[model samples]
Target chain A: MVIFGIDLVLLISALMISATPVLLAAIGEAVVEKSGVLNLGVEGMMITGAVIGFIFAVNTQTPIYGFICAAIAGALLSVMFAVLTQYIMSNQVATGLGLTMVGLGLSALIGKPYEGIKSPTLSKIEIPILSDIPVLGPMIFSHDAIVYFSVILVATVAFVISKTRIGLVLRAVGENQEAAHALGYKVVRIRFLAIMFGGATAGIGGAYISLARVPQWTEGMTAGAGWIALALVVFASWKPWRVLLGAYLFGGITVLQLNLQAIGVAIPVEILSMSPYLVTIVVLVGISLFGHHTAPGSLARPFHASQ
Target chain B: MKFKSVLSGVLLAFGFGTVAFAADVKVGFVYVGPVGDYGWTYEHNEGRLAVEEHFGDRVETIYQESVAYGADAERVINTMAMQGADLIFTTSFGYMDPTISAAKKFPNVKFEHATGFKLADNVSTYSGRFYEGRAIQGHIAGKMTKTNKIGYIGSYPIPEVVRGINSAYLHAKKVNPDVEFNIIWIYTWFDPAKEADAAKALIDQGADVILQHTDSTAPQAAAQQAGNVISFGQASDMADYKPFPRVSSIIDDWAPYYIARTQAVLDGTWESTATWDGIGPGMVSIGEITDAVPADVKAEALAMRDAIANGTYHPFTGPIKKQDGSDWLAAGETADDGTLLGMKFYVEGLTGKVPE
Candidate 1:
């Protein structure tokens, strides 16, 4: 069925695929920021994950194993950021930037051998009856496992952050690290774990591009996706559900702009290409003016055990 | 006595290293996209490999991939020159200014910029006439398109890309009068997700044939996933999707040019020149026309390829009109190199203005 000269089913399917990577990265970053640590090396960890995941998937001939290694690779790179920021008390922003550069270089080196090589693709899951439905069925019920996992991840994160006792401690550390430490909470340990979680998710996000989206390893394939994911965290205002909404919104605009051109809209193509970034800036400004900011209190601040 | 002997050996090794470095010609490449793109940059890197294979111990080649094209390109080119690279290939249109500027600074090093028009004493520009291949693709697309609607995913609105669009449209229109061209410029050289999304959008809008200037296999993948769509490869032969969506390709065969230029550098005969060769010079070769196309259409396409190669046919043969109804080329008149080199206006019948 075509609506406004666009196939509704195909548009939604493409939207989900395009948004999944950013959504995963943003949600992971949201969790990291909520734990009083701001790891700005999502791009670095993601590229690292992309290369490592691609290599493993190619060698093992298993897409799932590749994802596991990608997550591990991301976490391992974050450990470097964690050590510098948490243990050595380095500046989070500078160190995170360094990590990103390092990740880009490292991934390029590792991915050199795997260039132009295709990886094992993940097969889409189609529900026998549901997938046969008119419009909504193909769009919603039929997708690869990762798509469903992303939605489930959002819900799981929302529940944990709002209701669970562990979530309270994590939020407490972010709100007031010193106070949380005085109250006998293991602030450093909790923050370390949160950073690792962020790294793992970002890794999976990167891997998604290589293993599913493009299904091939290319040097710098993540492009600026890590940076986009980083921006998405702020756009979400530290909420998991909002991250999904923002990612899909960006994806929708990206897809819609192309559709507009396909339907022969006379607007210049440059303007259409710039629409997503322009909308992002406008939305960010709108959020600042109307939406209440929910940033962690100790967002970029270093925590010290002594005084 | 033993220590003195060891010191003499070390001095001998150091002397040999300097001699080897001075003797071997070092060639450097700066790529706008990654070598893994399997498209434009990948083909250039293959040329680089060809240089290494041809000269063996006489030459050394190194490349920096995924380099951004503006100030960063200037820095990378300068570094290559400073590091004693005798010849450097700045492979992208956006690297034109940087290549020229770097050429001014490093007079001794020869630089070649691809798909650009600027040239200096130390910097030569070279590009393939890809429009010739595009014309063949247009023929096949026009003949085989079930919807008579062809969707194009353009990278940027540069003259080179604009030229390809016009050539394809002209040929498509010749075969099928009802053929309509829908162009979507995503403004990126390589972004699989964006390319795929663009392909999907075009398919959704009743475009059964897809053509792309962007460097990725994603569009072919998208077309294959959608089923029954016809597409052609750009820059390189995407053989992985052969016989179906990717019916054929416009291959940029830079190996011969790269080798010839490198040989000239070795011979000290290299000079600044603007080379815009097409099939006649063998710079652009049409890839295999697969079985996906009908036999009659494939034969016609191959004949067109041979005619273009043998100089019997020019893709931009005249009697053309601009989009504004102005005369671009009169009857039996061909487009001059100068106008084609800096093409800005669209030919008659194509919709929309060229983006500034």
Candidate 2:
């Protein structure tokens, strides 16, 4: 079936790929913000992950190893931000911005040698019976493993954040770190672990761009995707499920715009290009009107044990 | 802030002092995208390298890549001017206004912008006539394709890109009356993922031959993966995909122009002027036509290329009509540079409006 001259199956497929990376990065950032840490370096962490992930995948001939290295590289880079903001009590916003700069610069330096080199791409995991299902199979089950992993990761994060003992402690710390500390929870340590998780997930997101999406490494390939993920977190109102919806919404509009252009739409290309951001802003505004626009209590505030 | 400004003042003084010393000429380049893109910026970076190789120590060239083309571009250009750059090349269309403003700030520093119309006393606007190459590509795409449908992934609705789409469509329709052009305007200069997705969408709609204006090899790669498809490279020669999908490419050769401009600065012959060179002047080049193309088609394409080079043919010749069916070019009357430079409408027989 075709809608507005765009084929339904192809549109769904395009939406899945476009939304995967942004979803991965946003879900990771949602966790970071949930821990009372506002790490603005998601862009940085994602790009570094993309380069390192490409290098390893190309060398090891396996995307699994590449994603592992990407996560490690992203986590290591986030550690620097963690030390500055968590321990040294530097400004989170400034440090996060600096981390992004360092990430972009360092990734450019590291990725310089990998230019023009083609890395192996990840193939989709198709289940025989399920894949044969009309419409949904090709749209859902036909994507690479990372697409499934991102959804599962979001579900797992949502479950762990709401149902687990650790979830309670993380929520307590994010609500009021001093109170969590009084309850014998190590606020800084928990926040540190949360930040590292964010870095790793963001790395995987970046690796997804290099290893599967475009399946090649180019400098700054993340291309402001990290920023979009950051916005998605706020747009999702820090909920994992909401993050998934928001990412798909973003991906859908992006894919739809391209399809609209291909189908000979007479609207200006600039208007179509702005449709994704425009719809996103409108949705965010609608959510705000519904009074769900609140951030973590200590989102960007540095906590000191004695103070 | 006071201390920083004081320090900058001192540095500015020193920068001027170094310029006065003048033992070597320092040329700076501000690129809108990363040099690793293997497309527009990559070719410009190559031109910068050519400058270094040609002049050695007599000229020192430096560049900052991936600069955004708005306020950030203005600031970057200003910083380069303040750092005592003898001549700076701001290589992107969006850098036009910033380059002019920066040139106004530093009257001593010469500036050159790519694919822009605006110029100042110290600023020159230059671009390649890439449509000449597109005409050849159109001929090839017309001759090719078991599916009679060709796809074009446009970067923006700018006149330059519009000219290319028009040239390709006009020439393709000339060779094959049944051919159809599917154009997708992707409003970005260098996003590979978006470019690739556009390519896939086009191919899904039965486009067997693809053309792109964006700076990425992703579309070529997409065409390769989709087998039985043909594509052409843009900005740089992506010969890696040769013998199949990447049959030929439009190469942006900026080295000779760069070297000559630098030489002009050295000899005190530098003056702000507009330059729009094509295949004839070697600014726009067509990469190797591989054996994948049938001998007759290849010969015809090369002949068209040579004709453009020798000024025997024009891409936007008369007998063209606007998308509205209004007369744009009368038969046998070629388009002048002014109309082509400010082109904002699609030609007749092409679908969709060129977005304002």
iRMSD (1 decimal) for each model: 2.2, 1.7
Best by TM-score: 2
For model 2, what is the C-alpha lDDT against the true structure? 0.90
Q: Which lDDT tens digits does candidate 1 get at residues B1-356?
A: 99999999999999998786654689999998878777898899999999999999788888998788789999999999998899999999999999999999999999999999888899899999999999999999999998999999998899999999999999999999999999998888988777877887888888999999988777887787778898898899987778788899999999999999999999999999989899889889898999888999999999999999988898898889999999988888888889998998899988877888
Q: What does DockQ give for each predicted structure?
A: 0.56, 0.63
What is the TM-score, restricted to chain A, for candidate 2?
0.97
Question: Which whole-number lDDT from 0 to 100 does residue A307 have in model 1?
Answer: 58
Clashing pairs in 2: B318-B333, B319-B330
Tell me each candidate's RMSD, in Å, in order.
Answer: 3.2, 3.5
lDDT of 1 at A46: 86
CAPRI level of candidate 2: medium
TM-score of 1: 0.91
* DockQ-based class of model 1: medium
Q: How many pairs collide in each candidate, listed in order?
A: 0, 2
What candidate 2 gets wrong by more than 4 Å, as runs, is B1-23
